[model samples]
Target: MRMMLKAVVLWGALAVAAGFASIGAVHAADKAGSKIEVQKSKSPTTQKAKARPVSKASSSQRVAQKGKVASRVSKAKSTRVAKASPSAARVGGSKSSRPTQKGKNVAPAMAGGVDLWQGQEHLAVRSGSALVIAQDGGEALYEKNARIVVPIASITKVMTAMVVLDSMPNLQAPITITDEDVDYLKGSRSRLQVGSVITREMALLLALMSSENRAANALGRHYPGGLPAFIVAMNRKAASLGMSRTHFADPTGLTSNNVSTAHDLARMVAAAYRYPLIREFSTTPGATAEVKGRELEYRNTNQLVKSPTWEIGLSKTGYIQEAGKCLVMQARVADRPVVIVLLDSSGKQTRIGDANRIKRWMESASASGKATPA
Candidate 1:
């Protein structure tokens, strides 16, 4: 009881102090209105820890606890604010907005302000890795140990898609989702089921978009020359892409030896980008279909797809005990196309947060670009 009271008192003091925090001038003019006050934070803002006002179950508290909708007015205001235009973003705060041609209304945010990863260990920590985003041509953002070779888990599927697309392009080709396709792919979420009848194209969608191991395996099994031929082709495709550091032992990224550096993976993503189908599939979100009389639901593995600030063109997510959490993406930020690769992130959410951090860093750098005030 005393601790709670003290917490409440501290919260009040902080709130009062914030009102006089002397944040100087930060304002925003938006399409909706110009009343937004984006005060320049003197210190990194701490998120209000959401501790409900000491229980007692008020109507509002109940609603929030149950995850029920907040008041309609608040929700509408939030939605409108999130959809704020670039012009409005310029009204105040260091909010940086970039254009994106693909996803609707989402502005690509650059690695915050340029040297996002600078001074912050230029390489992955131990099992971790980072990239030096390139500005010219189609090469990696610079890398170290990126190609030292590690188990890639689902990162392997990008290569599988490349090989399968090379060998199998007929969308109308009928294929059955057999038990072999669904075998050994335990613990991973998938919509592919045994005995489901789907087109070859559908299998590819699941393999790449949904990371359905069963779908990937089924595609491999359905290869005209079977698994051996499929493996041979996958290797051949890697060599053809000039990915000397990569080797594929399976169609799915589940195997331990499915190794590739962030650099090689970047090359893989660039190659994948050439295929319009791959791009379409990689960026697809929340698609549905029926297989074998059962409803199949597919959702994008990347949550940033729903972000209002990202113009993600193509993306993939991978994870396994051996590979940790991995993500690779191509998105335009500050109108510059950048490919981001974060491998072996410690937590499931860290990779995504890292992307956001990088975006913020880039924006900060761009805002002050090579200029010293007189």
Candidate 2:
């Protein structure tokens, strides 16, 4: 009986110790579960930083971080796109569906393309207006304000010669210079004095070759119906030549009302080139006329006609304060017929320099296959 009671007490102590150890283990597991819950309750941004790539976030993360954080991320992305657009357009389109910024200006660049010969170096000229065109081809090789009309100065003489020849007037008839033939308006002097008598043909020759204002006036005065009638005829002839922009206020071009564009002057030069007498008389280097039994020599007004380098077919030069130095010509350049008109040239030698530069450019174009075929 004593042995049984001792064994029973020892068993009771062992059972109580086992129960306490189980309770302690249950409390440890509950505390561990509570720590996991605390970690899961963190803010979305912190969770996202820990869980996602720094460069990009998942849509779910963005939605999870709604309000201020999401708005900030969206705004930053839009700003980045806006800053990249211009550079992307310069390099090439960033997106294939989006139109490039540079695409709008492409057509104008092609339309006003650089000349075939003027690849890098543009031809520098001083004339206020100029035009260089192939005679038969109608190809404009060069142009500068060619359509703007201004006073044509004595380039009017070419038209005067054309009209005089058009009338088929009696070439050998005597014409007397009078006070009416004098340039009273401008006070411009003339070598042809009053009462000087010359044949109509000589007057025409002097008018064209020497740019003799009195000679031109005498020719106009001797017309079938006089100076006013002659002015009417001048306008009629200009209209006939398709020189729509040209207007002749007087036969001498002394009046600034005598306005014409380089484009119209080119047409006039082309028409003048057709008349054989005008061509011969205008290009004659020098001639002598007998006035009051005294012989006076009158040289051609154009200096280029005397130059060996020029193969000028028809040429004229004119100047006044209102109209700066002006020149027009029909010449064969690089074996091709071309018409050149230079107007309002300020420098004394700028017209000649421009002509030389044009010739050199044409020759260069021909050599390099840049010239348009005739």
Candidate 3:
């Protein structure tokens, strides 16, 4: 797989020189988009990311088998990564250009308050953000702006969880941080600094629970075969997981180039829930733990963590100006498994509102289904 990824990188570079983006251009406007730790290739996680393409949905493949773009609106037309991204190369962009998935499921809006007043105000707000709901064999319920990739803030940790868990055989291994790990190319939020050594388990916890940028960087740099190899693995893992519509330019979401749509993230969340550790870490409301012999307390970012009604197994939240307030979760709605993704919300409350609306949508859908005859 590593050898195959190297070959693909070579091919992609050649393809790029020939006048097309091997991957979608990483936009320059969002600097905080590059901070997820589970993205670096050359390590075990990268290897996991490489195989992700194997499970791809044939109907949603935007790129041709020839590895070329088919249309401007669909398949992420061959836009130059350099031209499209004024944002300088981050961690994963230079690696394999593993195309992401396409074809998101979408739901239509019923008549507004005038129709029946399904308690819209109390259930959720009207933020108009894009949302995706997945349940029962990964079918989509509602989709908006599910295709226009944008910055994804700390939510990049979802990939971090996937890649790190799959690549590292020894989860208990300790990874040390360097000065470079904490420092940002642009500006990024971080409480950790150089010379801090923490176990892979702890690092994963810090990155997901506290949204620590330093923890994310250290994990990538410490990855075997170095940064380039780490990136290759992320792309590969994404491909194997059938997440062709998603791409990782950096380990951290601190770079503007880290873009994804709500539907793509839903695909990611569905996969992340498969991991027990990921499910626990993302949903834990608060953790009073020790790191590096120092007592450190951390809590889940999603405000709903304390709510008993969520019934969430996994959850994550993210934000960057370009990405807006973003969120995704695996939960039980209407007594069944369901995944939700909300992106580019107007404000903090919008994501919550989106969640409420989804719950209501599920209830309404279930009710409507019962009313109809087989």
Candidate 4:
């Protein structure tokens, strides 16, 4: 009986111990699963530290993100290069650059002026009033404030020359520069003193080539009906030529009242180009004449006449306080005859710069087949 009881107690203890061992194993497995869950929760923060959403993205999405970043970097580099370019600097840095005229088929502005274009190329013209016309076809090439009247300064000498030549006066006739010919109104200096004697032809040459105020005044005084009649003839000639906006108060162009528009000046320039004497005298680079037994040297006021590159047929320059600097020219540009008129330039070199710009623009246009000769 004792043996039987001992056997049963031992079996019961063994069964209880087996049950406790199984429970311990299950508890260890549960602790491991909890640790795995905690590590999984920390993985998202580590992923964010590496790359915000890319680290979790698929391979294809990552490639697309890299491409977007490269594109942005390339665009930034291109922007820097464009800002540093010389052409861009010129367009942005020049003080005289201005926007194109509204509703005009013009190009963007360049240094020192507005860019004007009728076709592919643009010209930078600095004058306040400017015009360019084809001499043969009368086609307008470029225009800026061309119709507004402004003081013409010494350009009046061109009209004075025309009037004198029309009368067919004796070229060899001796004309005396009297006190009346002295510029009392403007007090302008003159190489021709009172009591000096020069032929009518010499006076006209001086007036045209050198813009001599005294010579121009003497031409008017020696006209057929004196100064009053000369004035009348000037107005009549202007009226006859359809120069409705042109007016002349003096032969010397010293008077501020003497004014004309760029349009009218183009007509005057085209008309003046017809006279062989006007073309010769106006384009003469320099000349020397004898007055009162003294030798006086004179040079052309328009410097382009002396430039070897310019095929100038006729040229004139004028300046006064009220009129500003002015230039008129009949020249062959880009193998075509054209008339250019510039007025009211702010600086001495502005008109010349504008002329060169126009020449370059025309040549460029002709090369590109954008300009056709008339």
Each model's total of backbone clashes: 27, 0, 46, 0
The per-residue C-alpha lDDT of model 3 at residue 116 equals 18
- Pairwise lDDT winner, candidates 1 and 2: 2
Screening candidate 2 with a backbone cut-off below 3 angstroms (N, C-alpha, C), the clashing residue pairs are: none
Question: lDDT scores for all predictions?
Answer: 0.68, 0.79, 0.65, 0.82
| C-alpha TM-score for every candidate | 0.63, 0.69, 0.63, 0.70
Candidate 4, residue 42: lDDT: 79
Worst 10 residues of 3 by lDDT: 112-121
Best of the two (2, 3) by TM-score: 2
Q: RMSD of each candidate?
A: 31.1, 10.2, 38.6, 8.2
Per-residue accuracy of model 4 over 132-243 as CA lDDT, tens digit each: 8777534367777888899999989999999999999999999999998887777889878888999999999999999999889999999999998998899889888889
Residue lDDT tens for model 1, 210-271? 78888888788888799889999988888887888888888887777788877777777777
Task: Decide which is better by lDDT, 2 or 4.
Answer: 4
> What digit string (tens of lDDT, one per residue) describes model 2 on residues 205-267?
888888898999888888889999898999999999888998997778777888899889998
Candidate that scores best on lDDT: 4
| Candidate 3 per-residue C-alpha lDDT over 235-320 given as tens digits, one digit per residue, 9 for 90 to 100 | 78778777777778767787767777666677778888888998888877877656567777788888887787778888888877
Model 4's lDDT to the true fold? 0.82
